[model samples]
Target: MRYLKYFILVLPIVIALEAQAQEEDCAFKLREAQQLYDAGRIETIPEMLQACLERGFTQEDRLAAFKLIILCQIYADDLEKAHAGMLSFLKRYPEYELTTTDPVEFRFIFEKYRTRPILDIGAFAGVSLTHGLISQPFTPFNLNNAKPKYTSDGFGFQAGALFNFYASSNIQISLEPMYAQSNFQLVYEQEPIEGIATLDHHEKQSYLYIPLSGTYEFIIGKFRPYARLGFQLGLLFANNTSSSGIFEGPDEDNLENRNQLNYWVFGGGGFKYKLNKSYIFVDLRYNVGLNQYLVSPDKRFTQPNHNWVYMYQDSDFRLNSFMISVGYARSFFNPKRVN
Candidate 1:
């Protein structure tokens, strides 16, 4: 009884001491990784961070550790892991960036995701250029032009992500959701008018795009060839920034009545290749809009006194793009901070 009492009393103290020791070790490791990164010695930071991760730190520690890992991955020129990492993180923590106080730091992480090993991500800063073949019909042009139902060029920007379950290195089942914005002018004229009424306009669409695709990848050394079949779900985000009404010209009117979102079905395919620690990616996809720009009851989908959103729901915006996104990624664990 006496021995048991003494053992019990000492065990808590011993355990507490051991825990403190482990925490100090993790703190030391994290500091070391940050220092090395600050010093621009990136390659070794991962190793050190991984050591700390393996030591089983708290959740906050793990989060910080992953951030370091991501930076190391970017510096090391590993894109495959970067893309996969972005997808994984966003899916798990979609609004993690929104919750942070330091948006600039968060942006650094995003810029890291957008940058390529061969090309700077900053080059594609505002616009991400892309090209993909249409395996499915993604064209949203009106055989007849109305308010929002019309055609432009075949290329713009597919600025969202496509999801896929990789069955294997060469095969994956895909569910890709993307978003894009396009600014263009619109012309509207009633087919049978008493005299002649014409309207010239400009508008933009923010689409909530979703595509269901099956991707078949062919691996030849570092080269990858893939195919896809899917459609897009477009949601309207905004309308004409500046426009003219039916009675005036571009400089003479404000046409807020002609904004809408549209949906469509389209498909395509493309190829990608890998580099030492990065990748080069490209694709060509087509968009086919299924609905009209505005229904019959509302010409231009306009209201007597306000914007179109309050009058009626907007259809999917008729906008598609040929997209190219490049990414790099790597895995790391580091206990020393290097610059």
Candidate 2:
């Protein structure tokens, strides 16, 4: 009985000693990490902190390391990475704090409401601009306008459904089919026909772009952001009846008059939300032209120069995009258990 009582008494002392040893070791490692940091040997700090974590440090230890990591990231001028790290740390140790310093208030502002769902589905309709070869002014067979201008900005209309299949809590696959139109007009802008800029006669061209893309998303609950890589196969649907007239020149100075279905790279990101099992979501994307529209050389009717350069100005390649459509999301996933 006496030995049994002694064993219990010694066991607690042993446990207390082991815990004290572990804390001392953790403090030692943190000091080492800070020394390395002061000496600008920063790459070794995470490794050191990770080692301490492997040894089961106190919550305070972990929190202090995280806060220091934030300061380090700030000094490194990597705001995006720093913000992401701060957010992630708060997720794992929501209440961790240090004895010497008060926790930053901003660190936990929206934490409780930040975590969100993994899958989403929805449909949306918005305006788009076909920054493609087909001009818009000559569209609808501009039997009216006789001139086109660079300022002949066009409009696009689109409607489609999108689905997000989250591969992981943090990664997702996106699939969507959207019907869209690119319409624009070619006209003379500043250099007027008689030294005056007017909405002169314009020719419009119209086409449809059906893009198939795969996207990788980086998720932080309701804030599901992503990057996409996809190809758009465009189809020529309408053009100016004036194509055979003023536009039908050699495929040189005027490719807009002779544009065909083309392809481009599509990529962009947006925020997401959930409404129920059947959620609606929104995202913004941009089409970057990969093919040259106008084959004209800057030699102005001269032969191709020795330098095989792309005619960007001749192609008039600019970003074509959609707006708030990027973040307007409505997901309807029956959250199994959000709390």
Candidate 3:
């Protein structure tokens, strides 16, 4: 039993030492292959590096090996193998950018292939500020005698995923599906039979939204700045309201008098910082509501309990929102010829 315990502890160290030895052997072989290439032994270079390229080379070592092998095939007048080698190099390192130190022949071969991302899918979470655009005011009491004010009183949160399909190097079409929550407050003073009373009402709503957009991106160094224009469709899934001051009660579900479908048009711009094969991005957007959020006028007061017990009537308003979000995305690429 003691020997078994010791074996378990020693097993990992043994495997790690073996891996280190293999890596060192591969590194020595790679250096030898480079020297052979420099000495004009181009024909033997492929066989010299084949074993390490298949197994023990690290990521950086692998890139250097592929570059060296492709150059050797080019020098040997093996154009078919050279082209195939370039294709495999691109597939392995899709985000690689050519440097000035690269040979002119390498640049020529790289230019013959397209290595842009085919699609990028990611998720994001953020906060939003919502403003109500009131077209008409509603009150259980006489509007002539009382004044009501509506304000965005709280921050809302949202989370969603984006599906970005690239049409070209700088153009893409995107679909974003999100679940969002928002809040607003209403305050008013009314003259009751005995005295004046002040009331405050807070409403919270949750929705499912899908926005389809077209994006134009500017590739500037590692920062990609982009602008998007889109229209969104939203379905209200939950609505709850609570009141304070003179008329106060437990929170009540208020989805009955609210419109379920919301239409919006939004535009925004942001930048992304490339990190390896993934990107970290920040986005800002403003959504303009196309229609009122309340039900039709005749149906607004259909719930007698809402008016008599709660003494609350929803105002006819459109919701506009400004949102900021940060997210990460991984790009998938298909390397091929432009033709």
List the candidate 2 regions with Cα displacement exceeding 4 Å: 1-121, 130-152, 163-165, 195-206, 241-257, 294-339
Each candidate structure's TM-score, on Cα atoms with residue i matched to residue i, is 0.41, 0.42, 0.86
- Location of the lowest summed lDDT over 10 successive residues in candidate 2: 305-314
- Writing each residue's lDDT as its tens digit, candidate 3 over 1-339 gives 999999999999999999889899989988998999899998988888888887888988989999999999999999889889999899889988999999998888888888889999999989998888878888887788655656777899889998899998899998889999998887655443225355667889999999899999999889999998999999999999887545568888988778899999999999999988889999899999999888788767886656766676777889899889889888999899663
Q: Is candidate 1 or candidate 3 better by TM-score?
A: 3
Error of 3 at 89 (Å): 1.4
User: How far off is residue 206 in model 2, in Å?
Assistant: 4.5
lDDT of 2 by residue, 8-104 (tens): 9899999999988988988888888778777887765765676666465787687677666665665676766566666766566532333435335
**Winner by TM-score between candidate 3 and candidate 2:** 3
Which tens-of-lDDT digit does each residue in 1-339 have in candidate 1? 999999999999999989889888888888888888889988877677676565556667867777767766766778555455555544434324334553354455554432211111211112332222222221122324333333342234545543445454466565555566655543333331224433333445556656666667776666778887766666665554343333432332223343344566767777766554334566666555565444332443344322322221234343344445443322111111111
Q: For residue 338, give model 3's deviation from the true position in Å.
A: 2.5
Better of 1 and 2 by lDDT: 2
RMSD each, Å: 17.8, 18.8, 3.2
RMSD of 2: 18.8
Ranking by lDDT: 3, 2, 1
- Give the least accurate 10-residue stretch of model 1, judged by summed lDDT: 116-125
